[model samples]
Target: MTAYLTVVEAAEHLNTSVRFVRRLVAERRIAFHKVGAHVRIAVVDLDAFVQAGRVEAITDDRVRRDLSGAA
Candidate 1:
């Protein structure tokens, strides 16, 4: 079953302040749902948001290219 979390729950899960989560909602950076007067975020959406922010390590070839002025 999919999990739906409140803003406070999402903040706790992300180990961030509730205000930060609210900011995300305000910025529409993360997907959220409106239930009447409440806001909820899907666990998957939160995970996807985190994944979208991931930064992969640069490869050695890319580093070499940059160093050689090939970029």
Candidate 2:
């Protein structure tokens, strides 16, 4: 079953402040739902949001090649 979380719960899960989570909702940066005057976020949506910001690590060979070109 999909889990729905409150703002505070989302913040805790993200290890961020409640205000930050609220800002995301305010800016519509993250998907959310309104249920009878309450805001809720889905675990899947939150996971997607986190994944969207993921940056792949560069290998040492690529870094060396770029640095070599600077010489």
Against the unseen true structure, what C-alpha lDDT does each candidate score? 0.97, 0.97
Model 1, span 30-61: residue lDDT tens: 99999999999999999999999999899999
TM-score against native, each model: 0.83, 0.84
RMSD of 1: 2.0
RMSD of each: 2.0, 3.3
**Model 1 steric clash pairs:** none
Number of clashes found in candidate 2: 0
Candidate 1 lDDT score at position 21: 100
lDDT of candidate 2? 0.97
Weakest lDDT window of 10 consecutive positions for candidate 2: 62-71
* Candidate 2 residue lDDT tens string, 1-71: 98999999999999999999999999999999999999999999999999999997899987998889964
Best by TM-score: 2
